[model samples]
Target: MFYLTVDILGTISFAISGVLVAMDKKLDVFGVFIIAFVTAVGGGTLRDILIGNTPVGWMQDPIYVFVIFGAVIFGILFRKRLKYFRKSLFLFDTIGIGLYTMVGVEKGLSAGLLPIMCIALGTMTASFGGVIRDILCNEIPVIFRKEIYATACILGGASYFLLRKLPIEDIYAYIGAILIVIGIRLFAVVFKVSLPNIYKVEQ
Candidate 1:
């Protein structure tokens, strides 16, 4: 139940984020829906394919499609209010990564993957959706930037495994790890923190 809830929340978050981006790009209704759909499930689809989860996830479950459709409609209707929030895209994207990271980690554990591989899968699951969305929108993906994006997922995934090693319950660890990812992302954004620039400045 908890896992389902997390997955649904992640779907909604990414869907809304995609809607916002597509709308900002002045896309039509169909374009918006397509972007939202891809942003909500692209990461999970890729992860499933890599792990040999045949048929992928969204195809096996129609709920994800319905959820993305609903989210796109909601985003379009509330776009004005969302614009007022200013950070709406960042907030939803952060939440999406936080939830999706754990979802992927759980899937990895179920598949009996090693801890490092699980963390990699978690990071990929939390990031690839946005990458696809960005590519479609003709923008650079956040994961390719120096932002604390996938790094947060890696850290959170590591924390989840570490927490599981303790005496605490799995649910608590799951929630804690999600919080850690969200917190790290929020902190990074709020403080303007990012990876050090690697390119040499022109004289």
Candidate 2:
């Protein structure tokens, strides 16, 4: 039940983020839906395939489809209000990554993966959706940038494992890890913090 809730929340967040981006690009209605659908499930689909979970997760569960559809509709209707928020896309994307990271981590744990592999899966799960969305939108994927995007997921996944060693409940640990990811991302963006640049500037 908890997993289902988290997955749905993540789906909604990513779907809304996709909608915002597509709308910003002035895409048609069908294009907007496509972007939302892919952005919501692309990562999970890839993760499931990599883990040999055939047919993927969104296919097995029609609820994800319905949830994304609803999210798209919500985004369209409240677009003016969303635009008023200005940073709505960033907000949803951050939330989506945080929730999806834990969802992937949980799946990795269920698959009996090693800690490092679990963290990798978690980072992939939190990132690939946005990657696909950005590619489709013709923008550079955030994960490929010097921003602390995937790093946040790695740290958060590591924190989850560390928390599991404590006496806390799994649910608390899970939520804590999600918050850590979100917090790190928010801190990085708000404070202009990023990975060190490697390219030399031509004077």
Which candidate has the top score in lDDT? 1
Clashes of each: 0, 0
Model 1 agreement with the true structure over 1-203: per-residue lDDT tens digits: 86677667778888888998899899999999999998888888889999999899889878999999998899899988876755765676788799899989989999999999999899989989889999999999867877899889999999998999999989999999999999999998889898765564432
Q: Candidate 2 residues 2-41, lDDT tens each?
A: 6566667778888888898899899999999999998889
Clashing pairs for predicted structure model 1, backbone only: none
Q: Candidate 2, residue 118: CA error in Å?
A: 0.7
Off by over 4 Å in 1: 1-3, 85-92, 200-203
| Candidate 2 total steric clashes | 0
lDDT of 1: 0.88
Write down the TM-score of every candidate: 0.88, 0.86
The C-alpha lDDT values of all candidates are: 0.88, 0.87
Q: Candidate 2 at residue 46, lDDT?
A: 83
